[model samples]
Target: MSEPRLSSLRWRVTVRRHPSAFLLAVQLLSLVLYPLFDEMRGGRVVFGAFGVLALALAVWVVNRSPAIKWIAWLLAVPAFGFSLLSVLFASESLLVLSSALEAAVYFYAAGSLIAYMMSDHRVTSDELFAAGATFTLLAWGFAYVFVVCQAWYPGSFTGALNPGQPRSWLELLSLSFTNLSAVGLGDVIPLGSTARVLVMLEQLAGVGYLAAVVSRLIGLTLLRHERR
Candidate 1:
């Protein structure tokens, strides 16, 4: 009876793996899918709904997958806030808001999934590598939008983009990512007080969340090696 019960659990895990992999692929696709958005209104709607959906699915997966708890699935809070802001503002604010929130989701989601893959030795190196590659692509895409925002509409870009000062294009993209990761590098000055506060919050979330991910991975490695 015990053997059969264990087999059932194993089979369930095997079945879920494929679906989980597919979800991860689609979630990654949604990142670039935003830039291709038909129009501003449509983009905002798609971005908000898709982001919210991804986080919702993440909530489910993180709860069931004990391996990812290290990344503290609770970090999805900021990502959720970004989506809400995008839906509410749904104007010039939507681009910055949606981008930031999506970045947060991918960061946490990808990081948590990495921890999950690492802990589950059954997961293939190829699959894990593919996940990492996809994440890098997502990161670069966000970084690109941040750049183009400042480039095409220097006076028009909203949110973290400073309308007042003459910051370099690299500086602006860096700021976007810094804000996306919630990392506030003091060297690049904030255009407004609100942007400053937001930057601080982003930096906290970014560093704290990544720390959680790394800590989990290291702990698991230690345990695995110790047994060996």
Candidate 2:
């Protein structure tokens, strides 16, 4: 009844009504912020925090069974903690493990969201947002994969702005999205066999995903029209 209570109630309603929009906003913001900061110490911390928030929002937005929900929470909490610890200690092993876990979380969450959207007979704006979010998350996941590979084998990627230096996450992210979109600008080149294989796989995936999503959206639109 009070003003504060009213504000809290309104906030809760908005979240409940537009969870996908909120998740998409967080995904976009992280995509921007994660690349902007360059300081190693602070950058990792910010990245860790962003990972936690993004995964949390993703899990919340997707509709899941109780068992799947529990599993998501189980994986997400430890992934977040490990990420923070890896940053704090500056441990390469821990960071690699954290990146693996984070990648798993995002992959699972994105798959679940996509599955949900596909299963639903009626499509909404939220479904469209979820699709975009899933695509972006996939890019982020692969970027971390590139990071891990680079860590394991130095000089895995070349042609970055700082040539001959270890590539930053931001640079990798830029490369990942560019590769995922099949832009192939050639500014960033993957040198190692492993890196090249990963890039090729990502390019195939990007093309396949676009095809699938476009087909599904069109099918859904046709179905809606037929029902009228």
Candidate 3:
């Protein structure tokens, strides 16, 4: 076979065999790339592009109904497009709106993937990948919400996050996962009632998700072992 044909075959096989893993890898790569790009000029533009790419991959990975896929595109395209436009136009309102939309998209995607993963009786590597990817998406979804809150009501967070500059996506991401893990490090503190409420809700969600999903996955794994 020709090189192009071989590459095409590999792509098809990968998408068929490990779509969840591919999505997980891309999501992780995007997180790493976001922080690195922050140091450069036009970084937000690059970041927004990656966000769109990740959103597309997420839609593909979920492999939901046509209507659902269309809905994902509707939310994700404007979220990423308006984000890039906000950076260019220096519109804080647009940025906040875009962040909210992005959060909504990720939340939907994460919920869908989690449901799909948990629906299965047997545990597989793809299921494991989907589980991790869902967690990452949840973190990102909350991070975007945090960004929106911070943008809408400046000083929502009191420490480490500077009001003068946009919060670092990476730092917000860290805070999100920390909150999800219920670590509650004091370095970044939520000041406003709204912020506090949001934090509490996220913590609750994280704990609930772990208790339900992790336990289910473990149970399935044990059952598979018994059957074997």
Tens digit of lDDT per residue, candidate 1, span 1-228? 699999999866753554345455655576456556634554544554555465546435544755444343444455456556656676546545555555555555555555555566443433444344334424433543443344444543343455365444345445655565554453454444444554555556456545754444456567777888
User: Considering summed lDDT, which 10 consecutive residues are worst modelled in model 1?
Assistant: 132-141
Best by lDDT: 3
lDDT of 2 by residue, 54-138 (tens): 6766676566578787777877788777777887787888788777777777777777877877786778877877778778878
Q: On residues 1-228, what C-alpha lDDT tens digit does candidate 3 reach at each position?
A: 999999999998877677678777887887777777777655754565576567666666567588878888888888888888887887878877888988998898888788777786878888888888888888888988999888877777765546556456666777898999888774677778888999999999999989999778988889888888
Error of 3 at 13 (Å): 2.1
TM-score of 2: 0.90
Runs off by more than 4 Å, candidate 1? 1-15, 18-23, 64-176, 180-189
lDDT of each: 0.50, 0.78, 0.79
- TM-score of each prediction: 0.44, 0.90, 0.90
Clashing pairs for model 1 are: 182-202, 182-203, 183-203
Per-residue lDDT of 166 in model 3: 49
Off by over 4 Å in 2: 222-228
Instruction: Provide the lDDT at 102 for model 3.
Output: 83
Question: What lDDT is obtained when candidate 2 is compared to the true structure?
Answer: 0.78
